[model samples]
Target: MDLQQLPGYLTMALPLLAYAAFLVVMHVGQRRLGALAALKVPLHLAALGLLLRVGAANLPTPWPARLLPYSEALIIFAGVVLIIRAVDAIGVGYLLARLQKRHVPHILRQGAILLADFIAALIVLRQYLNLDVTSLVATSAVVSFVVGLASQDLLGSVLAGLVIGVERPIAHGNWVNVNGMEGRVVDVTWRRTRIETRDGDFILLPNNVVMKDTVTNYTLPSPLHRVRVEVGAHYRHPPNQVKAAMIAAARQCPEVLAEPAPSVFLESFGDSSINYRLNAWTMDYGRQEAIRDEVNCLIWYQFQREGIEIPFPIRTLVAPPPEPSAHEQRQDQIERIVPLLLDSEVFQGVSAPDLLAVADRMNLLTFGAGEMLFNEGDHGDSLYLLAQGRAQVIKRTPEGGQALLATLEEGQCLGEMALLLGLPRTASVRLERDSRVVEIKADLFRELIRAHPSFLDHLSRLVDQRQRANQELAQALAQQKTADAAGGIGQILRKIKSALGL
Candidate 1:
């Protein structure tokens, strides 16, 4: 505890105490300042350097004393790295906090650290070690030239990477197409950018090549991406009608954006048909293919409903098959419709002649999966008999969410109440699978009733029985309990007569 020895002890303990404090700070700030993880090597070097210096001062060995200069150099290098890392962490942390982003670009951060390391090394050599850095550089000029010449491509890639980092034309998670290769950017490094393709393949493109190639970033400027779908329709249909159908199809697709409403353009007149272009915006670039497929399928269904033909090419002159006569076509349709009508409980007791007449008047409409046959609150005058696919009856709840009330399979009927009363559709019917529906219009029902007045009683009783058996359907149709109690069959007959203007 002598005063003279206290100074010596303080000198020995001060550096150790300082190193301990730095370790604590690094540990505490590791989560907030991610850059501290890069300090592992330097931290180890600092410990070894401190130990070497201490041994040289107290070991009473000439060799230890001689190693003091090299140990001091190691300590200086470690100190420079520590200072650089600290600055990087603070600067990056501030930027991320202000910008609310997870990180700065990888190239910029690494490049800054490397440049700082080079400058620190030169200063340490010239100032602390007293080596003439100017002479050292001059002596290595020829070697530097040789190395630079050999790594010209590497150097170019590094520069290009720097440019990319600064410009930020592409970033991680961006969906981009470069030189016909489309993928999501996984990582960007000084030499190469890694992209993950949709097929789960990783592609490494050198930064120079990426910079040289034309790039299309679907997720830049905004995440919303515009998709174009081209289709051909028969020239018989007016452009406005075709456009309306195409736009409707696009809007029905769940992937398409509604804000910037879908649009259609008449592109050109083709040899066999008129070509149209549909432009829709969607934020999901990953599902681009699926979205396009859905839109195309929907367009087909819409065209089918609108009686718009996408004509076939007339490449070579060939004799066409003779068209069926009107009688033959009606017979074919009757055959298809009779099987569906026979299976339905609603048409149970109708006379054979009346059933045949009703079948002739009914039209078969095709709908694609996920297509709405009729949405709730729509004014519908046709009753749909599901003949070939599954459908879901979705009722909008009071809370603004939809509830699946029933799933309709083959031989099921919908819109009975709406068809009878000429009221708005009470529930939405969406096809779960591609469906063929026999749509019986109000005029057909009125014709049957006018010819046979007993047909009205039979139809009304059938509808009432079906509604009473299915409480969910009744509630969805908002059928009042009082109406059922006050002679449901009679009320329906009256409503049907009034609705059909009998």
Candidate 2:
């Protein structure tokens, strides 16, 4: 090669050599850190800048040459790109989150990168291209004023976005209400903040408006939220009965918390009805609407079952009063209780006369949903035969939480072993819905057992079978097993025998 062309060859060859070295470094870096691949655009720009600058200086290129002046621009552009990439690679947002223990705004992190790029571009143009920095900066000042005047609202929005990023009031993915517009914050950009509404629609609110508006962030401080459901019933029903029904409905919802318990408030007497407000606490706010819907539906069902009237706005011209006769009421009670007793296996040998006698000694009890019949450690003096609705058997766990064992519907019975053997209640029974039950006290039960000699064996076997089942359920639920008194079933039978004086 000729000596004159040697410098040009060397310049071109040197850039190729630099480019090859960069490729090797990138390959290793990408293998170790996959995120490094995001720098591909800036890395290629830097390689082009090296090639252009080297060729312009060493090839004896003239200033009048078209490509000579463009080389300076290429170098400055490359430097700016590198500055931005470096800022992004450093992960300013992640660093801020770790240090401050809060989320940093994406706009602030990008702003920092942009500021660095501007500074780096200015330095490269001044030092490498010999550009007059002071005059160029003065010219930019005049251009900026013209641009700002043309885009007044645009500048305001940008400034508002910057202020919001610095204030950090609402983070992304939070449920918020602004001027009654409720949605989750999806993203905050330079000109606007995007919100995703509950109906799955996107709303872009200008940053300036978002800054000026009143924002209520439901997800802040804690995710636990209380849902309020409003209900109204006719004045014919007692307020206490209505409140009981509403509270019971809330308890039946699985999402509702039992610790805080549900509460019902009588708001006011409306034109045709009494208004009520029910409150239930839950942790799942994302499903807040569905949870509230379930509670309202449950309240409707409960009101219908309890004979509570939800009045309309129309006034009644004439209301009729009807009285139920004594005979009819007695017959209704007999029908409700008799079918339940006859359906049970334990009451198979209990004849019509014996059953009627037992029923006469029993009390017809009504429990609102979620009311506990008896706790695990309580002295059990009665057995309950459910006549209507359902109940759940729950054993208290070691962690102070209740674990449900079984659900008992109409015709099923509870507290039998406790009533017969004079033992502590095995598990608590809570009403799952408004229910009617015939409760037979221990003395009444014992008297009946004494009249029927064959019943003793059947009752003993039933107690033994139930205890084993209860133990197995406790084991599966990981609750502490209820220990028998010293000798297991033998001991329990002796206690029963002594209680009945058999």
lDDT for each residue of candidate 2 in 118-189, tens digit (9 for 90 to 100): 677677777767788888888999999999999988888999899888886676888888888999999988
* Ten-residue stretch with the least lDDT total in model 1: 477-486
Question: Which numbered prediction scores highest in lDDT against the true structure?
Answer: 1
Model 2, runs deviating above 4 Å: 1-69, 72-80, 91-95, 98-102, 258-260, 283-285, 304-502
Error of 1 at 417 (Å): 48
Q: What is candidate 1's CA lDDT for residue 402?
A: 97
Q: What local lDDT does model 2 show for residue 130?
A: 78
For candidate 1, write residues 292-335 as lDDT tens digits. Answer: 99999999999999899999866557798999999899899999
Instruction: Rate residue 346 of model 1 by lDDT.
Output: 67
